[model samples]
Target: MVKRQAYQPILITDASRSQHDQLRSRQLRYIVMMSIRAACLVVGAILVGVKPPLLWLWLSLCGVGMVLIPWLAVLLANDGPPKEKYRLANRLHRSQRDETPPRSLPAEERPHPVIDAEQ
Candidate 1:
């Protein structure tokens, strides 16, 4: 009688998020960052109009945020999830010298069927 193999269950943790979900998340992050940048511009304008105390410092902070946020947002939006450790490209490249040579099984022990020319 042939033996049957046991069933193996797939784990959900191993699955990656869908591309649409990932893209939606990245788009949301970019929008939030841009919103913050707009807030900085508005704050800078308000500081200029009011001539607040330490006006230069307030303007500088806002200016820095306005300049840096878009650049950072673009970088983060373009970035993807990190590669898995077990992926072939991410695995360490080993030289042939570091590996053990493949072992050959003896003819008597090998599972292949023997064919006879006389049969």
Candidate 2:
């Protein structure tokens, strides 16, 4: 198994308050889901024999929790705040190549490929 790393920053001060709150809540959501999953396991074990039919229900619930919790937890935990969305797009670890803006051409000067190709 690969070891996980805390590579991301917890909060960016320059970001908006909403983004900070969103990041904080995202981490909390993962913790809550994980706690629920653990509770399912503990309750399932305790109820395994005291109620046999209900055991199946508990096990099914546990199964679903087990399957979904880790994946969703990882996703939520790894998710970045909304403000970073556009900034991250520009910093894709690509080499320091020039990303100059495209030269603008006036509507009249711009090539009308669709118009010309139809001829």
- The residue ranges of model 1 lying beyond 4 angstroms of the native Cα positions read 1-6, 84-119
| Model 2 RMSD vs true structure | 17.9
Full-model lDDT for every candidate: 0.72, 0.63
> What does the lDDT read for residue 40 in candidate 2?
74
Please, what are the lDDT tens digits per residue for candidate 2 over residues 1-119? 99763233233333344557877888799889899889877877777757877677778988888789888899888887454455455434332343433346344333221211111
CA displacement after TM-score superposition, residue 99 of candidate 2 (Å): 31
lDDT of 1 by residue, 1-119 (tens): 99873333333432467789999999999999999999999999989999989999999999999999999999999988766554323323422224432335443332222232222
Q: Which 10 residues in a row give candidate 1 its minimum summed lDDT?
A: 110-119
Report the Cα RMSD per candidate. 12.8, 17.9
Candidates in order, TM-scores: namely: 0.66, 0.48
Q: Per-residue error at 50 for model 2, in Å?
A: 1.2
- lDDT for residue 92 in candidate 2, whole number 0-100: 48
Clashing pairs in model 2, backbone N/Cα/C closer than 3 A? none
